[model samples]
Target: MCAAGLAWEPLLRLCLSASLVGCQNSKSFEPPS
Candidate 1:
């Protein structure tokens, strides 16, 4: 259980960071009106 918790922590953080970066990139790449 301890080992699983340790591994899961970084995976969760990576997913969160990736989602945030994707959102920022999408906003930046929008076409101008």
Candidate 2:
């Protein structure tokens, strides 16, 4: 369980970072009203 938690933690962080970056890119690319 400890080893699994360690492995999953970094993956979860990477996924969160990726989603955050994607959200920032989409917001930046959106056209102004």
How well does candidate 2 match the true structure, expressed as C-alpha RMSD? Answer: 1.3
TM-score, prediction 2: 0.79
Which pairs clash inside model 1?
Answer: none
Candidate 1, residue 7: how far the Cα is off, in Å? 0.6
How far residue 33's Cα lies from its native spot in candidate 2, in Å, is 0.8
Per-residue CA lDDT of candidate 1, range 1-33, in tens?
999989998999999999999999999999997
- Please give, for residues 1-33, the per-residue lDDT of candidate 2 as tens digits: 999988998999999999999999999999998
Error of 2 at 28 (Å): 0.1
RMSD of 1: 0.9
TM-score between model 1 and native: 0.80
